[model samples]
Target: MLDTDAWWRDAVIYQVYPRSFADSDGDGMGDLPGITGRLQHLQELGIDAVWLSPFYPSPQHDAGYDVADYRGVDPRFGELGDADKLIAEAHGRGIKVIVDLVPNHTSSEHAWFQAALAAGPGSPERERYIFRSSGEEPPNSWKSVFGGSAWERLPDGDWYLHLFDVSQPDLNWDNPEVRAEFLDVLRFWLDRGVDGFRVDVAHGLVKEANLTDWTTTSTILGGLDPAGPPPPMWDQEGVHEIYRSWRRVLDEYPGGRILVAEAWVAPASRLARYVRPDEMHQAFNFPYLDAPWRPAELRAVIDETLEANDAVGATTTWVLSNHDVVRHASRLGFPVGTPRMPGIGAEDPQPDAALGLRRARAATLLMLGLPGSAYLYQGEELGLPEHTTMPDEFREDPAWERSGHAERGRDGCRVPLPWEADAPSYGFGPTDASWLPQPATWAEYALDRQQGVPGSTWELYRTALSLRREHGLGHGSVVWQEDAFAFRNGDVLVLTNFGSEAVKLPPGARLLVSSEPLDGDGRVPTDVTVWATL
Candidate 1:
């Protein structure tokens, strides 16, 4: 068993989108019992912790993010007792549980929001959430993440702020009552034996007090042909105050709980602030994930993130894919030159299949060898490729409607896990039909298929995680290489050949793990390689 004290610092956290992970009942949805049943599979993959997305009681408008209650488990996922069993079972297997904390907003149907609406401006509950007068417009013209005005008109003709879906109303972090309520929520889970949290939309806790329109003329979301004014409240400076308070609350726990922030922004320096000791344990560094599949670009992002964040004395975290994004294989030139596979296209063809596996293993090594914690989306360890053809009718993500179908949406990556290759429903459910169809080609990529294969991506993940546990790879300070993509500390050098062709390692460097096989002395004569330790 890995040590629980610093488990998260170097840990490989497997993200389980609870609704899609596994379903015990024939409900065509995943639940706690299903996850509890699958604990041994997670143990086999060597993941130190499991980061379950929000399973709190919600109306299901924003999938569990629109939390109606913070302390209770969603009946759809399971009862409160089921959650306790899952926690205990996970801990029994030496796996820590870090649940997603959506403290930034709550469902519109939540009792707090309902009370605020009923009481209007005069009630003390009015301070629990952001509510503006009918005469006053939203503080600014900030756009909601789901594509409409960030402010919603209430029944009383006033406006309430919602940064994402209209169903998700933003809480008033500046209000002491709001902060105390969330602290109580934190203690609720901590008392239940949850190990830590991956704070959702962490930077949105506080907005600009001036309520001024955005003025920064930068274009990072899309093109900047005629750069538009920046949204007034994307990354306001005041959010840190609340974060420091939350950090203190976490410290009050016995185990010194972990806190990871979902801070997605350009310019690594700006993202680094969230990771300072007083704020968060680490913030997601998405620059590398957003970069093109080019050696120089990847190298530059790695160097800049490490260097800039080093100033703040906090580690960086990396993720390639999650529920919100497309799968990595398709994103990074896999099955090159093909428009995404049709929903009914042939399964990863033979030779191409092996190539895809190799590339995934290489990328996994890159993430693991990086400076901080690494996040693995649910099926990534099995090298699961994206489901290219999610029909419109079956699409559950709000991104589909919000993006006007311009983007394919995140349903591809959020497909249910393929637990049993020959099972009627690929083991996602007892019935053959699931909420989302299991990819027809999942047989070859199922966990059952790859578990014991010596060079499978599954084995590679096991090896990488084991190396991290045995060596202090995630704990050490990173020393960047001048020209290449390498980080070293003392005698240990972790190098990656992001190129397609082979590259020679610095003299005396030994290959600990390589995308391809190495010679007897542990060297990769050709490209797309990584070397660790000595």
Candidate 2:
């Protein structure tokens, strides 16, 4: 059930990538009607809310991130009326809805962008975006997150900055027009009864003055640098003032509306600023997600996470996997220190599936037992792994092309979900075709096949979520145990065995649930996590 008072503080939100979630029209793609029909499945899964990825009208250059309209839904997904119905239906079921807001950039096809291009260099239309005069060499040394130079030169010899794909033009947040437009956009969705927004590129809305050159030779992933003076393009102090204004707008509405930042900032303290009392409500705990699967490393990240959030009077948010990264079910199987890749292809080294699933289950229990909110990618509960062998011909991710085919990109994790064991398209839609082809082995992981099966990942999640709410685990404070790998939250103790040997539990402890069954010796085995009362 949704908590009426500050529900987002400890809510478990499920992210739905609209195109691959479920297709109701048999058009080979998922849509609003399709998602409306599948609400029952999420309700059964026990999630407090759903965070739908962008469905705004666009050319699909970046899979709907390049929004052309802030107030209307894409015709392919559904009309504005359909979105209204969805919000009402979801609210009736005691579930909140959060929609993605892409404020950093807009599609080149957006009316504002087209006018900017037609208005030439110095017009008011062009001021809404970053446009500068340049020679043949281009204006700056900034690199695109997708690939190539960050600047795109037009026929008029002027260039516009696009930190991502060329079809997505970065808005000049320095301009009053751009800032005021987004404020209106925020109120537009909140008026439609959305619970909140997942702000895309939340750390990138503001850039340093003068647009200086960045010459660091560091390898960056998802706009994150390990350690150094960060690039001027991200996490600027001006971004905070923007969010503070946004906070005021959110406070105007009742029912505790929230704003979640998808910021990838560094040093736990820097991330905490995004969640300050007057800023955002929550920022994703990426350090926890990026930490290697080891006891020492995991413990350190947890401590850091808790301390950082506590200082700012904000609840911490935990996430294992999302649309832009490899699913944890496959990622945890790789050796520690392996650089996280966008996606794996058939030629890539395959992960140990059995080992990955075991660790993933254990990780979920540990994360759910923590004192804060958590997010689950759509199919992670089903133990879904990446479609590691997708052919290059079927790739749709812009990164694949932008990187000149060196990276396989994230299409593998965005494949449609399997709902039935024997149904066409695994019951993802009425038609046999899915946006991206599904793996032939997907049937075994179908929801119908794992429904009531003991030891199945689906059943494990159902049981864990039920217990989480029942025991107030999300609201509990952690007390570290004698073993660094174990912690007690209220009356429940959660321990994870990261070593190769089995660990014996203390005497008189009553086991409540475990990721895997105990060994014959009644000890916790390697890569296993258990919750018990002592």
Candidate 3:
């Protein structure tokens, strides 16, 4: 068992995108029961905890990020009883649970949002949301992260802010009601036995007090310059206060419940602020995720992350891929310095699959050998690549329609998991249909095909995780080796070769595992990573 007090500090958390993880009722969508049925898969995979993406009542405008109710389970995902059962089952297997919480905005169908619309211009309900009255133009020049204008106008000559989609409206955090409501919402889940929360848009809750106009015409995804002045809409000073309050609430519970910030703020130093002693326990290390696959770039990010988190008295949290971004498996296939895209299309330049898989495996080994917590995106263990060839007509991500078809959006990476290669729907459910169609090539990556196969990605992950736990590598500090590309965690030395030629190992070092097989000379080949005993 993990140390109960600080399990999150070094825990391996698995992210389950509920809609695409597993389907229980053959409704063509994954649900709570589906996740519960698959807990053993995670247990066998050796993950310390499970962090499920939002499954609350939502319109799914942003794939469940547009929450309609904070305290209830959506009927499509299953009833509240299913959630309770899932939590109980997870805890029974010694696995913790972290649910996603969307506090920055709510679905327009939410009771509060609906009431605000009905209550008109100056009602208390309207005060709960960011409603502004301006002639014809929007309150400001801010653009939605999804696309287009950030404001939606009503017949009453009033407009409301929506940083994402029109179906999701931003809430006025300055309002006391909003604060109190979220506090109660936290208690509701805590009372139901959730171990923690992964806060969505954690840095965006408190925007600039005046709702100031952004002089530049850029979307939230474009991001603020880390070296430049802060943007008015994100990473505001007020956000820290909100998290401080949340930290207190989390402290009130037993078993060390944690709060993870999904803050996309830049420069490692600025990102560290969210994880201060009294604020969030951990924040996603996005700079590391966005780093190029080269050894120097990876080492630089690792050093910055450790240093920054050290200054804040927090353990670093590392993640390679999530629901919002492209899968690293496909991303690493391209050359270094390639810009990140929402999704790849049939017409786009395709990745080198063999090279991508080799690097992705090497990266995962290096990530596991690091001295901090790690988050694994679902299907990554099976070496799943984005369904880059998915037909445009079936695309459903809000970014697709919102961007006027210019951007393909994130649907490619959200394809359903494959369990049994020969079963219907690849054993994702009892039926043969899924919300997003899996590629025909996916059969080769199914769990059944790789479960016990030597050198398979699934087996590689299982072996690495087992070794990581046995060696206490996650709790060890990193000791840099003479080679800038290598570091030692405890007695295990990890080295990655990014050059075109092979690299020789020390004479006395004994090899534990290699992301790829060594050459005839027993040298690490290009794009390969190896872990050995000192």
Q: Which residue pairs of candidate 3 clash?
A: none
- CA lDDT, every model vs. true structure: 0.74, 0.89, 0.90
TM-score of each: 0.88, 0.98, 0.98
C-alpha positional error of residue 262 in candidate 1 after TM-score superposition, expressed in Å? 0.8
lDDT of 3 by residue, 1-534 (tens): 233249888899999999999999998899999999999999999999999999989988788989999988999899999999999999999999999999999999999999998989989999988999998999889888888999999998889999899999999999999999999999999999999999998989988988887866554354457877687888999988888999899999998899999988888888899988888887888888888887778888999989998887788999888887788889888887897777998888888888788889999999999988999999999998888899998898998999898889999989999999999999999999899988999889999999889999999999999999989888888888885478889999899988888999887889999998999989999888899996
In model 1, what is the error at residue 72, expressed in angstroms? 0.6
Instruction: State the lDDT of candidate 1 residue by residue for 1-534, as single tens digits.
Output: 223246566677899999888989979889999999999988977888899998989998778889999899888899999999999999999999999999889998899988888888757887887777756466556667666677887667678888788888888878988888888888889999998889887766787676676533321122112134434455667878878887888888876587888865556777788877677887877776676555677778878988977788766687887887667755554544443321222233322445555556677776777756888899888788777655667776665566565444567777888877888678888887677777678887777787787877777878878876667667766677776767774445766665554556777666676766765665453335575555
User: What RMSD, rounded to one decimal, does every model reach?
Assistant: 4.5, 2.0, 1.8
Can you tell me which runs of candidate 1 are displaced by over 4 Å?
A: 1-5, 120-123, 134-140, 215-231, 334-357, 477-493, 504-510, 518-527, 532-534
Winner on lDDT (1 vs 3): 3
